[model samples]
Target: MTSISIRSNIQTEIREFLKLAIPLASAQVAQATTGFVDAVMMGWLGQEVLAAGGLATMIFMAMMMTGIGIISGVSPLVAEAYGAKQNRRVGQITRQGLWIALLLAIPGMMIIANLDGLMHQFGQAENIVTLADTYLNVMAWGLFPAIAFAVLRGCIVSLSEARPVMFIVVTATGFNIIGNYVLAFGKLGFPEMGIAGLAVASICAHWIMFLSLLGYMVWHKALRQYSLFKTLHRLEPKTMQQLLWVGGPIGITTLLEYGLFTTLTFFMGALGTPVLAAHQIVLQTLTVIYMVPLAMSYAATVRVGQWFGQRDWQQVRQAAFVSIGLAVMFLIVAAIALFTHSRQIIGLYLNLNDPANANVLNIGVSLMTVAAFGQVLDGVQRTANGVLQGLQDTRIPMLLGTFSYWGVGLTTSYFLGFHTDLAGTGIWLGSYIGIATAAIAFIWRFRGILSKKESRHPINGLTFKE
Candidate 1:
């Protein structure tokens, strides 16, 4: 291609990526707002509530990650089918994805219901364990609906119809905030349920979002031709197997990443109440920012999968590069914002003026400083993971994550927090190193894959068979 043609192509790819990415990023931010709202509301309750709720949330997230990862298979599959103009396959994949969601939910609910023993095993304080258990019991009911919504979202986003999902999520977030106020604090004549009330509100919000998306898929004019409801009763063994083959690795990858963070939460709990509370504040703040790159990653997966299906090697490379470039640029901006306003950000989570919370506030501020430094690498790794998923290259990425997060990251965290004076700072620094390692590995993998010549049957070659 001539220089001008190449420049034009690059411009076109960037425009297309942004069109899909902006709405998706907004939806991610809206979805994350539910958790942010939860933390903020819980923070107002008391330090104990904040710490206990944070622990419970981590467990809930870890469990949900597996389901989200499994359901993630739907996006790539549907996107590829849509690109190939195989509309029937898209419907089939989406339906099976729902079944997978339901299947995953059963065990998830069971585990959370029996979480008391597990939390005790983790050596959490007795009172905090009881509070967390209370929260988890009610929150467990939301798992099925939440995972089901995720599957629907995957299908919709893959088709580049993300606006409805974004609308529903934002609406659900608003609903959740209102519910938290009414149920948690006895507003509008409702009985106050404390942490349990938050869980109840979350459950209600999950079901609402799920139902709203389901209705849209069934009635939306753009999705009408897919006939998504036609094969509701039929079970396709091959397709289900395909989803597991693709989604299982993704689930494991998510588990590994979330597990690392959850483990860090455990380490913080061991340090002290002040340290744990501070850790929660820092984590919540960073998670909200992380949503930006996370959304771009999802967009990258959809865009790359579509290009891959069409056997458009040049566009695939363009999409991958464009997505990564956009994610890094956004992260750079976010990191600077976080670094410059570290104290102000932490102040949102705690009362900085209160003497009792001084230690927590100070620790939180310091952790945010470390978080700012690592934000760019965090965005890079997450976006790279998305790019690889778009190409259906999952297993190797999973392996790389395992080594980086567990082997290097967690080990370093343990040594520093337990064996050295750095303590919490040391642990936070470990995450930076781990993320940087994964980022480098994932980017290398994407470039290696992109450089390969396209095969006649690209999908067959890249994807695993049942």
Candidate 2:
């Protein structure tokens, strides 16, 4: 191609790239907005309520990540199928994921609902246990909808219909905020239910989002082929096995990653209420800022899977490199914004003027500065990991996460926080190290996978068979 022609094609490719990526980014932004609203509304309730809400969220997120990980497995498969023009298989995998989601949610909801009572058996203080329990029970109501939404979301993202998901998520998050205001604080005529109200608002928002996605799927023509409402053949053992094989490790992998953070939060709770509240403030900020790279990762997964389907390895390399470049650029800018606004952002989460929360506000501000760079590495590694998932190289990633989170992240945190004096901030530092290690390992593995001189067996898409 001529230079001008090449530039024109590059521009076209970039636009095409953003077309899918923007919606995915919006969808992630909406997800983060839910937590922002939660924190904002809870801010009106003082540090205790905010701390309680934060604890509840950590517990809920850990459970949600484990359950939702099952659906992530479907994305690469669906993306590859779409790229290969295997429309029927996409529908089939979606069906299987739906069933799996239903099955997974039942147990997940029950486990989280009763987690508090179980925690107290270790002889914890009555107050913290009671608060955590109340939050868990109320949040449990949303579990089914959340899991179902995750499966539907995976199917849609694979089809590159990311825009509609953004619409639903934004709309739902808006309603969630409104509900938090009216119910959590007794705005207008509604009775204030405190933490329970927060829970109710989140639950209602989950259902609304799920129904909205369902409605969109029924009407969208581009998605007609992958509709979940259609009368398809009965469950196939092989299909379920295929999905389970891919999805099982993903679910386990997520549980390992999220579980480590959840454990860290639990340890933070032991430090003091102020520390726990500070951790929550930092976690919410990380989730929001991290979404950009997360969206970039999803885009990478789709593009890579599509290229893999086409057997066009060259395009696959281009897509991976391009996506990583975009993610790095975006996160660097985000890190700068985060560092500059660290104090102001912490102020928003805590009432800086309040006399009772002087300690909480100071600790949160300090942690934000420490957390800023951590999120950048988080973005880098996660997007790189997503690229590997797209290439269907998951086993090693799973091993890395397991070893890094538990062996490196958690172990280092314990030594630094307890053995030394870094405290909760040290825990986050360990997380940075853990993810950085995974990033190096994942990038190396991706290079190795692409550089193999011969075709490998198709089972794991690697040179080795399971």
Top TM-score hit: 1
For 225-340, candidate 1 gives per-residue lDDT tens digits of 88887869888989999888878889999999999999999899888878988898889888888999999999999999998778687788889889999988888888889889
Indicate the residue-level lDDT of 200 in model 2.
Answer: 92
Task: Give the per-residue lDDT of model 2 (tens digit) for 84-121.
Answer: 88888888888787778788888888998888765565
In model 2, how many backbone clashes occur?
A: 0
lDDT: worst 10-residue window of model 1 = 457-466
State the lDDT at 107 in candidate 1. Answer: 91
> TM-score for each prediction?
0.97, 0.93
Best of the candidates, lDDT? 1
**C-alpha lDDT of residue 246 in model 2:** 72
